[model samples]
Target: MGALDGKIAIVTGTSRGVGVGVSRQLLLAGATVVGCSRRPLPGLPAAEGLGGVEGRAEQWVCDQGDHRAIDAFVQRVVDTYGRVDILVNNAGGTVPTPHAEDVPELVQQIQSSPASDDDFERTVAFHAYAVQMNLISPLWFAIRVYRQMRTQDGTGSIVNISSGAGHPAGSPSLVSYGAAKSGLNHLTRSLAEEWGPKARVNCLALGPTMTENFRAFVLGEQDPEGRAYFANVPLGRAGDPDEVGRTCVFLCSGEADYINGTTIEIDGGMLPGVLYDAGLKTITDLL
Candidate 1:
């Protein structure tokens, strides 16, 4: 039997990119996966072959930034699935392309206009208002899912998708973005401590990786930042979306039951000062 052969998982932001990857991994592990996003998936029906997962899959549209929408989404999931065992809080992406930012460019924006009031406000809202979607939405989902899990069996997993930018010593260019993620890290640790023996919480601090969004925006033909970005990564490359997905699986798995209140960096061993001091050219030459 699969690790989650009979479980029901709620994966947010699964319309594309890393969310899609996480959903595929969960399904492969044998969970009926329900995907959520603000808009309909452009090609979810055709993208099911990932990891060869046979688990049931479905989707819905919900704005995670909205409190009412989050509650309604949870209710809908419970009504449809009868049980919610896992919640992948992956509903973040760059917003106001008319989207909720998962990560990336917000850092650049913060750096470019560090002192700009408009930039700071826009980054939080993504378009308008002051929702602070990145920091607030995960907690909303976590609380709701925690309730559902408690009612059923007093157990559940909440994986808050974070980033390397969250590190205190992480990228300076991403001040606001990093602040949000750092807060998320704090949230993950706090909740893990508070909801123990019944619920598990953790953070995944991702480094450079190639998601659909990453490819299109960061590494793809339209805008090639090139290999220089990987200069600091000891492994000297970007991580795959599936790599992040597998980590999520393991973090939520029975094996990692004791691994709570921790943040795992899926960053290809990209440590600060380590790679640069070691010399990228020498390492690449040896490889």
Candidate 2:
């Protein structure tokens, strides 16, 4: 029997990236996963019938950024399944907004001139959206899932997907995204303490993972600098999505019943400031 046999799970942002990997692993562990994305569900390219893994997953459309949509989605799950045992709040990313697209130029414009009220309003709006998506939405999911879990099993597990960009050092380009994720890290701890003995909550702060979008934007020959940067990482490479998924399974399974309110770093040993260009040069020069 699979480790998660008979369990029901809800995975958000399963159209691609970490969401796909998490869903694949849960299904392999024998959990029934209901995966959601803003877009319609795409075909499963990785975990379909591989080794005859018998776990099941279904795709649905839900704009997790919207609270009303989240309420509807959670209600739908509880109505159909009667209970929710696991929640992987994975629906988030550094989405580009108007204020974000030309950040350098915009910043220069604001600083070089008398910044208008409209400029400040637009900037705040952008940051607000980021916080809503990365921080508030996950809490919304957890609250709904926890409520349902309390009514039945009372042993539900929540895994919030985070990013290394959320580190206190933060990301310059991903300022809003990082801030929102940092908030999510704290949220995990707070919720775990609040719901303990009934359910568990945890977070995973991820580093570079080879996802479709990453491959397109960061890994190709066109981005040699991006490719070279991996050498600075301790592992000298990006993480696999399945790697993140496996960790999620371990956290959700009976094996991790005692692990609560923790945020595990799954970045292949890479950390900010400790390793960068200087470190890479020393290693490369020796070789």
Candidate 3:
């Protein structure tokens, strides 16, 4: 039997990227997965050797930035699945592009641009206010699910997808995005403490992975810079989405029951200042 046989899960922002990868992994592990994104996803074919279990997946359109939308989305999942055994909060990102170091001049331009009061509000809304959508919306869903899990005397798991950028100081261009993820990391710890033994809450702190959107954004259509970017990674390559999905599966499984109230870095040994020192030869070559 699969590890998550008989389990039910909700994966946010699951139409693509890490979210999509996580949804697929959970389904392969025998969980009924409800995937939510701003729109319907292009359907994926059944995995080889996994035909019978393929159709157990469903998708819902949701505006993660809207609290009511998220609440309704969760309700619909409960209505369909009967219960939520796992919740993966993976729906957040910034509106801007590239790292600050990659585009400091653009960052300065956006910062210095004159704006109407409304434009200023809209800017903050997209950056800072949007974070509440990512952090608080998940918290609300967790509360509602916790109540149900407690009533059933069942255990549940919550995993928030954070970022390595949440540390390493603020990337001026991604200031709000990093701040939001940092808030999520703290929220993960706090919720785990609050939920205690009934439900486990954890954060997955991720590093640069070559998702489809990321490839398009960073390397443009030609992908000329892809190899150069990968060279900077200590692993000498970017992570595959499945690597993250596998980690999520483990964290949500009974195998990780003893683990809680922590942030697990899935960055392929890219964090900690040591990785840079360990890659001294590569760094010098690049320089």
The candidate that wins on TM-score is 2
Worst 10 residues of 1 by lDDT: 278-287
lDDT of each: 0.70, 0.76, 0.69
Off by over 4 Å in 2: 42-55, 95-122, 219-221, 224-226, 273-287
TM-scores, each model vs. reference: 0.80, 0.84, 0.81
* Model 2 weakest 10-residue run by lDDT: 278-287
The C-alpha stretches of model 1 lying farther than 4 A from their native spots are 42-47, 50-55, 95-131, 220-225, 273-287
TM-score of 1: 0.80
The lDDT of model 2 is: 0.76
Q: List model 2 lDDT by residue over 171-261, tens digit each.
A: 6556788889999999999999999878899999998787876654344444434556677688878888899999999999999999999
List candidate 3 segments past 4 Å from native.
41-50, 95-119, 221-225, 272-287
- lDDT string, candidate 3, 1-287, tens digits: 88899898888877778887788788888888888877665553223345666657777787765767877877787777787889888876543433322322333233332233454444544454446655666666667667766655567998888877577555444556677788888988988888877889989988766677665444444434456555666787777777788899999998998899899887777654432232212311211
lDDT per residue, candidate 1, 21-139, as tens digits? 78878888888888888777644542465655443788888788788998898899899889898888887643112123422244335223222345445454442222255678888
By lDDT, rank the candidates, best first: 2, 1, 3
Clashing pairs in 3: none
Ranking by TM-score: 2, 3, 1
Report model 2's TM-score to 2 decimal places: 0.84
